[model samples]
Target: MDSSSSVKIVSKHFVKPKTIAEESKQPYYLSPWDYAMLSVHYIQKGILFHKPIHYSIDAFLEKLRESLAITLVHFYPLAGRLSTIKTEIPKSFSVFVDCNNSPGARFIYATSDLCVEDIVNPTHVPLIVHSFFDHHRAVNHDGHTMSLLSVQVTELVDGIFIGVSMNHALGDGTSFWNFFNSFSVIFQAQEINKNDDLCLKNPPVLKRYIPEGYGPLFSLPYSHPDEFIRSYESPILKERIFSFSSETIRNLKAKVNQVCGTTSISSFQSLTAVIWRCITRARRLPLEQETSCRLAADNRLRMHPPLHRDYFGNCISALRTAAKAGELLENDIGFAAMKLHQVIAEQTSEKVSQMIDQWLKSPFIYHIDRLFEPMSVMMGSSPRFNKYGCEFGMGKAVTLRSGYAHKFDGKVSAYPGREGGGSIDMEVCLVPEFMDALESDEEFMSLVSF
Candidate 1:
């Protein structure tokens, strides 16, 4: 975790440990549907490596155990009724293949002598996860590509990294973040309590197999023309954190509003337009390419009888729109602002939100492919910043971000509470060339205003 330590601590080793569940005296035929009932989701496991100087790994682990116990109380099954819902992790999870089987889902599996307290300088905690995959993932495919889920802790001041790989079917960002924050409270020694009214009576039994009728509302005629092919082909994925003063962005917003009509636009939308122009120009793709961006809209309001912060499950929806990148760039910034606001407001509805959930329940399951596509660079706003405050009492988080998810051409994550007022820490991951170009170009850099 420290700069002083050698960076080569990630031992080139692959290990997977497995044990089958003890044969119960009684056997039960749980339906395959039952497995879907439980919290397929995991509490995200990230590390806080302390400098090991004068601090024993044993001591740190003990603190971890205490934290774990506190977190476990808040851990509950997802809102559903499936026999295996609360099923303990399966033997099939890591056995017969590759996965370190990281202990406690978060811990320091030391590869070297240097510990956290000794770390005068430390890298991001998530880097550790990357190092493992780069070095440890089995080249020989052994049926378990879902191997990254078993988060492990390894020590080697080489550099600390935090990793969080959740089950895809887990709660939506709203619910998942709620779980993350709840778990974080244990570190703060705070209590994690469910909403008093959140009684789990008559949970939804809708099978994920059948996508319900959100049709007509969700269905749009997609007749593609040859030249205007809406082909999204490319393995685009990477993210990097970029900072901007809130004052600058606010001024940009005001100027944009004055130029455009009274239509409200967010700072995220304005920035997205600027980046869209840059990317369109850089790729040398169609100047008038119908570049579409999807806003990741939260749908806590979409459910019947209404769900609140604690109602976990995919409660997020997307609102997508398109414009000629060339035209967007030519107009004042406010034009793009109106574009973003219009697209988002249109999407902000129970009709669309339910449509998404219903679509998930449909027999025609093509949406999995859609998740990887870049969706407005994913601006996650209003997540509690208490995770950053978690200090081993060593120091505060200098910088934090939602790291690169290797599935988009580029994506951005906005975390709350920057040093300046009303500014969110924005992490932008794009093609390496774009990063280079952004660094070099005055005009593009000015648009981002970092």
Candidate 2:
């Protein structure tokens, strides 16, 4: 089958570790952030490798399975299943994971006649590339499907695509990347006759401690993950991927600073401001309509004494900035960028700590419905994630994509361009009319490569 057809599964099985660490064979508690995500699995992500390997398909699958199993020995929570607390007591309603005898992650081997060139075609049909991933295993839930990690490796004409579907409740982007890097390290060690005793580059720390007063706050009922699933299925949506050159980004930063009469402005502030403006303009919201730019900020270092880089689970806070549609459209890019900068400035480590403290008093509920409402956009992922570093004995990935971008509307996923250095890629999903307007946007098109 080609890119347009369903991915045919050649083989599928679980990849359990040959032996589990004695310390890991116990229940792992979910942090407040993690428990908050147990109701949804919106954090699925994937990367594509375009390098050709000399090994046969069977050999490649075997190597990957073996390395992943070894990697799971260190990052074992992913091998387990989430167990909701079963009691009428308010405090007992929280969820935790039973790590003992976990069935392990799912690994699937598949193939397609689709060429790399066709998969990246600018004029390709919408959602055609999503066939490269097994979406149901990531977002859908059933009695039989409990694995937190699901991987599908498809052999393309010229290269291979490794798609990872991770449950948000299991961990955040940091944990996901940590597991991937550990897997790569093990795979590389096995590939070459290197020392097998190489310590885990970033060993996971899984002890979860809930701040005092966190339990009583989450007692309120909120929308279910199933409702999110229903609202996220937008057949009328269109997803577009664009690459911004490092030079263009630099130019944008300089332009914003010059216009704003300021000396300092981050690339994120400038670029995201530009895209936010374009998306707002494309939507053509009325002047009085309010718009919000919600950017996911990693809070790993936001608390005093900072969470370790290897601290597993969700440690993100969405910093939002709101403005009137007319003001956003009428003002120059610098104004919007300055507003973004102010938002970032307001989220200091103290502020984040305060937010966490307040969260224990009243847990935050993620409202997926807000994304579908008019004039709002949620931005996620980052250039700082460095997906290219996920080398599994193969060379760096030729490109990276989530593949399942059609699952939501008005969502933007950003990543560092594989071209190296400061280049960036913005994967945007919007309703068809707004996408059309964004495509026809002269200013936006001038700065971006389709």
Candidate 3:
């Protein structure tokens, strides 16, 4: 059977919130941090689970559909659509969420002929995985007409894939996982006592975190969203998963600390350094060329007053560190690790506040094409997220996967290993030539378990 055509959609519909109060249907303003992500693509991520035994597929889908409605009640902004307000006097535009005009979140039910092994056992993730997510190649600004949140449940012969495509402007990775976790909690609770009222353990703090001098709405620099939108066709890229066990990660960290004579290097930093170095070597760029690594850091705790962890919007800052290709390649892993550690340490409350204040004065939107500069690597999604704990009464997830949106030559996403511990799984994307070079680099593959 053709893998691309294997996934067949059984039904598709919209799931509205169980209940929405009239007063709660007011506009939800976008934070400055959210405005900065206006042009980025939607975030597409999902989990692969072993098919549950003893439950009919019909019954399972019904429960999932019901719980989704209940979950939307708490995460109401997701059900809402983006609104572009224009002012004639100023000839400017601003965007906000119109809660009153919600058309509900998109829900899809699909069936695939593939099995668990078809997804988990491949060195390169199969192309069929891209079919699991909706809103393919759609940017976050498309939320003005598209659903801000889309959920797809694709059933395999021996597994299930629950894919979610969320608007990047609405939240960051922290917010994305929070919604997934909350949905699982409500789903599992229904299995226990269907009659009981479900409540989120960490209910989302929906208040927008605007700076002291900033108002709820900020005007876009452009007159229309089209002027700010960028179009780019992605090149053919290969994606592979590299697994690092707890022991391997420890050894990497210990090696970095031993060389640097400091214990400040974290496992994440150590791992990212190795990838940056290896990819640089694989690319075979000129010594004089400059390379950079950009990582997204959560800002909820870095705010002046420290916003709640449950804050339901974009609260993140990109930490970028650069080096000449020659310098990066000549240095040991310790050198690269320390560079990342230093940048991470610099994101203090004052620094975060300054970043917010500066952005308010001159707001800039991130274009998709500009995200992938040459010789650059972008690290997204942290291993700290509880990817495996999203249990819907059907055991833990076997692994995680991402969709086609926001993918570039050097995009890397980190996930906690399925076996737990400090292990990590990096979903790496690169050109075919670069991937071949990376797979053959023994020094780098020596640390990878798979």
All candidates: CA RMSD (Å): 9.9, 3.0, 1.4
The per-model lDDT (C-alpha) reads: 0.42, 0.73, 0.88
Q: Which stretches of candidate 1 lie over 4 Å from their true place?
A: 1-54, 78-129, 132-151, 154-161, 190-239, 302-305, 353-361, 364-387, 392-395, 401-406, 417-420, 447-450
lDDT of 1 by residue, 180-268 (tens): 45444444442234222232332322222222342211211222112111223334433455556677667767776677756377676
Clash number for each model = 30, 0, 0
Number of the top lDDT candidate: 3
Runs of candidate 3 with Cα error greater than 4 angstroms are: 1-4
Best by TM-score: 3
Q: What is the TM-score of each candidate against the true structure?
A: 0.64, 0.91, 0.97
CA lDDT of 115 in candidate 3? 90
Candidate 3 lDDT over 403-439, as tens digits, reads: 9977788889999988788999999999999999999
TM-score of 2: 0.91
